[model samples]
Target: MVALNMTVDSQTGERAVRFNIDALVIAGWAGRNREAMEHHIAELEALGIARPKATPTFYRVSPSRLNSDPVVQATGENSSGEAELVLIAADGDLFVALGSDHTDRKVEAYGVTVSKQMCDKPVADRVWPFSEVADHWDSLILRSYVIEDGERVLYQEGSVDGLLDPRDLIKRYTGTDTLADGTAMFCGTLPAIGGVRSFTTFEAEVEDPKLSRTISFRYDIAILEDVG
Candidate 1:
């Protein structure tokens, strides 16, 4: 299984979000076509998109490298080999950081869940209500997806959920007015299928002002047949 832990800023340090990811689905894909998968990974590296030396690894795409390369864009459509690379090249400009991983097992495929910890606070407090704080959190989550693979999406279906607003949490912990309106922040995560393409959608809901909630959903479905 693909295990992930997320901590949201709380008055007492940070709290973890509860979720599960099936590793079998990923492993099945890898097992069925390891060579094709490796070739696709090679294409990614050739374009400067680095991967971890181990399984269940995380990766990041530098903004500087992505903006300055042309070959990177040209290689985005080489079948499943270029799925992750295409997503990064298309969406990497918006994020300060990106994280991804894979596993070796076989099971049902659901989706990914991303949690947050308030590393920094906004400039002011009481300026933006709890609902607005939740909205800001939603915006940051939407901006975090940098991969734009036409075939494979970083997220599956109903993957993103349980976003906690740090406004009150930051204020209580820091004892200062840190979360103000229009304050900039970064948060969220993306799960990617190395070779295939997938479709995705984002959504949110504020159940309570005191406790905020948001969910970013992604779905995988066949869009077209063979065309080259």
Candidate 2:
């Protein structure tokens, strides 16, 4: 089990909490806009990944993959990070944070679930209470950037309106509107601006326009030598 120390940002104020997460779920094909979701599926299909059998598919990986560190290592150079909104249940309350569903592209072509397990999942250190921003949730924005050749380029950007509502997604995945404590879910991602590919450093953020607040994190990817 991995314990994550996260900060909660609410109207009342901010507090720190540590949770020994028991479950980690990555939700896929969860775009509320069917056209946009299909577009992302096509992006992966072009890379030889298969289509998911159902909409908003839930993938369970090890809780140990949950990481809030500034650095992550992945074997080979075929993995990349996609911006996502993570729902974390803690202290009997649900909070939302920014996440990067860092995945391995090569293994994904043959084994989607296994690919999701092959790398560390990066998460921001802080989160907003679900109820605090529930009224303005749709206005939240998700954006990511990748540093290539010392130049930062926009990777993915979109409003949360493009994806399924957090409550709705939770209900579909768990048969209930509530997420249990110690569980964290990566809700979904937007289509890459250029395309899905590898990067040495990835930075992502979730912004609440109405509240003028944002949660962001950056992680450098170190590719280890493949010795076989």
Q: Give one clash count per candidate, in the order shown.
A: 17, 0
lDDT against the true structure, per candidate, is 0.24, 0.92
Model 2 spans > 4 angstroms off: none
lDDT of 1 by residue, 119-228 (tens): 00111000122233344343433222223554323332212232222333334323564532212222222223343231221111112223443322222222233255
Which candidate ranks first by TM-score, i.e. highest? 2
lDDT: worst 10-residue window of model 1: 115-124
lDDT of 2 at 72: 95
Best by lDDT: 2
Candidate 2 structure quality by residue, lDDT tens digits, 6-47: 888887899998877999999999999999999999999989
Query: How many angstroms is residue 126 displaced in model 2 relative to the true structure, after the best TM-score fit?
Result: 0.6
lDDT of candidate 1? 0.24
